[model samples]
Target chain A: MNVAALGAAELRNRLHGDGLVYRVGPYAVRLRSSIDQVLSAFSCLYADYPVEPDDGFADFHVYVHRPQNLRRWYRPQAIFEFDGKVPFKPLPFSQSYPFFEWGLNWCVSNHISNHLIIHSAVLENRGQAVVMPGNPGVGKSTLCAALMLRGWRLLTDELGMLSVDDCLFAPVPRPVSLKNNSIDLIANFAPEAVIGPRCEDTVKGTVAHVRAPADSVARAAEKATPRLVVLPQYVEGANAQLIPLSRPEAAMQIAGNTFNYSRLGLQGFATLTRMIDGCRCFEFRYSRLDDAIDTFEQLLVGGEG
Target chain B: MNSGTHRWSVLPDTVLHWYCADDETLVYYEQAGTTHLLTATSAEALRFLEYNEANIGELVAVVSQTLTLDVDGDDEFFFLMEALVEQLQKLGLIEACAH
Candidate 1:
């Protein structure tokens, strides 16, 4: 049964007790939260995600709630608890939903070692996956979301997962986070896109999440073969183009953007380089999403990306 | 500088891993757990020093030959050679020994 089948009241009831255990691709997470905004977010952003059996094993036990003591009465804040340890200080109570998203990302990146997790976005079209590694403000997530709207299957909007043994991308299709101008940009770009509640005055400016497409959520267990590794940049008003990046440089760039490269050591290096060697790498720059989509479309269709 | 007083050689093959693409090379130093991108010249220089501990002059000969540049007192080549050696040594991929 998906979360939507539970209805808001029953979902809220479960969250108040032993928690709602749900699968996020490769891992199962048991989430406990009583905050209203966070509760509503589950219905809006996570409606399509199926609910696992309550007694099933969960990889992470997380909580988002007001602190127990008098601090909760003061400036009303919500703290994230990961298996009873507070990983981060509280944000305003209104930001609980985004905080939950960020905290879950923290849990995945910090705890998992079986995969070479790079801070990237993964999308697939015609069975070929592309991993785009970029720093914040590079608009990789925006590009990823736009592609998904154009019929590409979104593997993830963050945390590109490549297995250490096989280097194949394990899909963890979660909501695409949008911020500032991107919120309006996506709204304008695709009027039919479903966006969640907006959290104002957050650290990353006004932020919201676009729900992952139902098709992507349904096929979360599918792994993808990487064929293109891209370093994306949003250059204002520039023509969208895919510039060829040398294999050595591509390896370095991917290594630099990785979250657990040092922890994985030589195994990580071998995995990253093998993927780079097998794939066609590029440094992609664009201003308009339409042009970007066209450029990617041409690459996929012409077989010369 | 008194760089000529010491001989430099690459670390043993066991401690270093090399990946070549086109004219560029990426080397991973196992001890330092770091990867480095090297130019064709640096690759040639390291290739020469991998077999024999040589001073800067010998390294310049191999690297210049690989680049097909004249080594007849060309200041630019010498400067680039010295800089490349400095970079390789900094990465712990190469070290200087007493001649």
Candidate 2:
């Protein structure tokens, strides 16, 4: 059963007691939280994620709760505990859900050694995945959310897990974490999108998450073939253009934006080069959402990208 | 002046893997876990050094002749040669060959 199948009282009861074990991509996460905000956020955003049995092998056993110190009565704060260790400093209690999201990202990005994890956004259509890796403020999440709204299946918004073994793209399909103005942009761009509660004044400014589409969640275990690797540059007022990159340059770009590429050594080098050699790489510059979405659609059907 | 006729050869073939794309030549040094995008001149220089032991002057001559650079008295050519040799040596991708 998925998260949407759980009753509100049952969800709360599970969270407050032993915790709810759920499947997120390949990992099973047992989340224990008495916090109402986290419960509401999970119910709304992770509604489609599959729920695991009560006693399964959970990769990450986590908690989001008050620090249980004097701060509980004061300006309460929430810390994310992963496998018995608090990995990040406490944020204001109001930011609990976002903290949970960030903590889970940390767990997966650091621990998933079997795949070449990258700091990227991935989406797919026509059985071809486009992996977008850019520095912060590159509008990766916004572009990903827009493309996803326009019929492209959202594979992932934060972590782009590429298989180092067989050169396949693993589908994490987690919620798209949109920050600041992008949140409003997504809301206005796709009013049908279900956005979770917005947390204000956190590290990445005001932030919110767009729930993964049901189709993406349902096909969560499917691995995708990366056909196009786009290094997106979101220049304001610039025309949408897809410029081709040489395979070597694309390989360098992938190495630069990766999370565990260097650590994996030559195995990573061979895997990345093989993947880039097969993918049609591009430097995508775009401003308008409509034009960007149109260009990708044309690329999908026309093979122009 | 930095050349000093010191012979250089590329690191072992097992440690270095080359991938040439449309516009770039990239090499990854597995031992150091580093990747480098080489210029045409740098690529030629490395290839020359890979199969044969050559000092900096020999490299400059071979690479300049291969790419047809104005090496007669060009300061840029000299600078490029010195910098390439320095970088390759620093990256541990090239070492002073035993005479």
lDDT of 2 by residue, A1-305 (tens): 99879989989999999999998777789999989999999999988899999988899999999988988869999989998898888989999999999999999988988899878999999888999998879989999999998878888998999988889888899899999999999999999999999999998999999999999988888889888888888899999999988888888888888889988888888888888877888899999999999888877786434
Q: Deviation in angstroms for A131 in model 2? A: 0.6
- What's the residue-level lDDT of B21 in candidate 2? 75
lDDT of 1 by residue, A1-305 (tens): 99999998889988988899998789999999988889888789889998999999999999999988887888789999999999898898889999999999999999999999999999999988999998989999899989999999999999999999898999999999999999999999999999999999999989999999999999999999888888999999999988998989998999998889988989988998888877888999999999999989887775544
Candidate with best lDDT: 1
The CAPRI class of candidate 2 is medium
Provide fnat values for all models in the order shown.
0.55, 0.83
Candidate 2 structure, TM-score to reference: 0.93
Question: What is the C-alpha interface RMSD of model 1?
Answer: 0.7
**Chain A TM-score across all models, in listed order:** 0.98, 0.98
* CAPRI quality level assigned to candidate 1 from its DockQ score: medium
lDDT (CA) for every model shown? 0.89, 0.88
- Model 2 CA deviation exceeding 4 Å by range: A302-305, B11-14, B60-79
